[model samples]
Target: MSAPDQLLVVIDAVARRSDGESVRIAKDVLCAGAAVKLCLPDTPAEFAKALARRGSRRPVVIGDDRALVRAVGLLHRGRELSDGALSLVPVGPHGSVDLAGALGVPLGAVAAARAVLDGAARRLDLLVDDSDGVVVRGLRVPAGPSGLAVIEPGSVWDTCRSLVRTLVRPAPSVPTIRTHRLRVEADGRVLSDLDDPVEGVTVLSRGGVAEVVVRPRAAEPVRVEASAVTISGASFRYRADALVTGPVWTRTWTVRPAAWSLTLPAA
Candidate 1:
């Protein structure tokens, strides 16, 4: 049998504690229709080990976005993502598993689990950073103050939470999407230089290239599609999905076109 027919379901511990009911539901649903091997990992180390030993079974991650990202990151780092063919069942606190939903994974515990059993494998794009970190979701450089300010806004309390997830320190007040000086280059073409203040930058995976948008402080949004992007300037942080990483002086990310595959609802 192929990996999808025989599954390895790795349930993240946080998801267990936060919402055991959802986790249990996911387990029951997945087990009902497939040959399942379930593993509940307490630490990240154990989780990585589970994935490493997944063998020929499709790995269905039962947790929030962070857990899902962790699994994808591990497979990417190990150079196994090209054939990983992962699935997800979002079971966590509210607003935490938004990435899965955004990716078209069912939010409900039962529906998500069922999808895992019946969904079709679809190729997805990814952003691989120079640091070797993989971004399964889109990248965002939220418009911050003059200094380094990063935002991870995806919920109702975006402004309040964005202030807290800053690179240096929280802005005193939610400044009206202030300017940040960043030198952005997409495919070697300069979209914005350090001399030109920018509101921020967003790079979303599109087919084979990333849709790069540089929000200039004074000019219209500069847009381009590139396989690689380089950003340099004063130290700044950025949100790569659930993680807020950086404060680095510079960074580069190249699109790994159709780098990985996911199990989404079958048409």
Candidate 2:
């Protein structure tokens, strides 16, 4: 599809405080290129309200990855992600916008803004859980190396750099191998049972299935591809994208193929 002419520019308050110059640069580039309506939202409610009233204009978020994730979650829940493509400008401290860069958006304010006006909408797959939570990047066990499982972030590498960060992060102090009691199912097929304590579980969205890796301590990681994955344990938390979520006992995530579209620079 062609680029959008009308744009609803949402400059997150954090972005305004962190990097005013980048935000200004994004505004200059976007306003010069299209008809722009800017919204500087200070709170989550305000942000959602602005997006709700965006009307026919495309929403372009200017902030860090958290802002971008918030925008996506709001759009997805509102069932408007597919109707109107979202754009983003990465403006924040280092590591704050890695998800944006991992998603193939330019990190530079000027470049990202120009892409909003000149780029095309690319449909992407996302993981949607039963609780209506969305995972655009990927997720891992939130408890770290000792408590959670650690497996090679394999195929998830194709879609995000967050996994790369995970790989390069400094080693943890934990020396002994540990395990978490969790039962894992992939497409209704049992990959690991509760009897088999897990060291880690990694789930990443790819195509219409989720690339899943289940690791049991001192054993090789079991990999599978499935349309859905379910994990039930002693109320464990997981990192979805940049957010640490749950204490959820049992959680299920299903892949929605090409469910969302983002305005990205054309290849």
Q: Per model, how many backbone clashes are there?
A: 0, 3
For model 1, which pairs clash? none
What does candidate 1's lDDT look like per residue over 1-267, in tens digits? 564589999999999999999999989988898999999999999999999999899899999888988998999999999875899999887778878988899999988988889888889999999999988868888523322233445654878666668756756685665788889999899989888998889998878899999988778998899999999999788888877787788889999989999899999
| Candidates' C-alpha lDDT | 0.87, 0.86
For candidate 1, give the lDDT.
Answer: 0.87
Q: Model 1, clash count?
A: 0
After superposition on all C-alphas, the RMSD of every candidate to the true structure, in Å, is 5.8, 8.2
Worst 10 residues of 1 by lDDT: 143-152
Residue 173 C-alpha lDDT in model 1: 81
